[model samples]
Target: MSLPDFSGTTPQERLASLRRSVAGRIVFTTSFGLEDQAITHMIREGGHDIEIVTLDTGRLYSETHAVWAETEQRYGLRIRSFHPDPQALAALLDDWGANGFYHTKDARLACCGVRKVEPLKRALAGAEAWVTGLRADQSQARGDVMAIEFDTGRGLAKAAPLHDWSREDVARFCETNGVPVNALHAQGYPSIGCEPCTRAVKPGEPERAGRWWWEQDDAKECGLHVDADGKFVRAKEAVQ
Candidate 1:
């Protein structure tokens, strides 16, 4: 599976090129953050040939849901949503109890594995390209993200159109294009995740300071961005 070296002066143009390059379905997964919203806006407004989808962790903030709905209505597109398996959810609750992720890093990662990463695996099933709204300055783990890379774990090419964009670049695009964004961003939540794990960043904190604030020392990822071999969490089905 060799992918061509795509070229463009802008992210949208590069994305269009990528879309043209792929022969099968190209999926774009959004978390409804500022960066994701920006990418969604570009995908919808440009009318590119790609499928838009999301993972409903079932533990998101109302604000996150609001923005998700708003993006749908604003673009007049129904973004498909994948949710955690009901059986898996019940087993997680029985074993860890609600809010158990707050007690330990392992528990948190397991919760993420069940709630986010597993659903993402389904959402990305059979996709030729997986586009995401990742920026270089987002965090240390993701600082090396290139415009495109092959995800051997998923057996597909992954694209990060906004890889070199700055936070200000995303904000500006969202504002100028009227993209629906999470309301929490205005209240100092530079990074938004599940309501229980995320918080408002303090002054001088990094952009992702709000996510999993209790973990004093860890990368700000939920297993999605990490390499297949270096997954941030262990995704598995619940015991029957």
Candidate 2:
């Protein structure tokens, strides 16, 4: 399928075309990040019709939840929630203990698969197109992000409307549009995720340096970005 042409068009016009084309099959996954707030604002203000949802990993920051509520109240949009399979999570924890991920890369990834990737897979099932807040400048793995691309790993057509946006651009859009954002961003948590697995970045550290900080060189992402292609190689392999 040919991707929607999101070029040369204003954000409003492109959003309208996306809504008309996908109808009810388009959805946005909001993690309550700054970029998400900007995109949600655009979609809501532009009057584009699409489903908005989030994965309830059951471990997000309270600030994230606060923003989630504020975003809904401020925008008057119903954001659906998807959760992990409780039974599966319980089984995994029973077998590996609550924090076993800290012991090994495999264990950490297994936990992510159980708690995040699986739930997201189910949440996105049957959707024709999924939108994200990923930007090329966010990480080494995301440097090649295209505005519209196929997620071969997820079997979904992914749209990253803000792929080329700088952090300042995202902030400017949010500030100019009155979009609600998570307080954690102002607190140095640029990349928000499950609470226990995330932390605040220190001065002069990379934005993601606080995440999985104990693994030395060989670890970074959990598993969400590694899936089928191994687009991101484990740093351990590079050291070897």
Candidate lDDT (C-alpha), each: 0.84, 0.76
Would you estimate the TM-scores of all the predictions? Answer: 0.93, 0.89
Off by over 4 Å in 2: 9-13, 217-219, 232-240
lDDT (tens digit, per residue) of candidate 1 on 78-155? 999999999998999998999999998888888998999899999999898898887778887666777877776787
Give lDDT tens digits, candidate 2, residues 112-187. Answer: 8887789888888888888778777887666766666666666666777777788888898888878898999888
Clashing pairs for model 1 are none
lDDT of model 1, residue 225: 76
- Give the worst 10-residue stretch by lDDT in candidate 1: 231-240
What candidate 1 gets wrong by more than 4 Å, as runs, is: 228-240
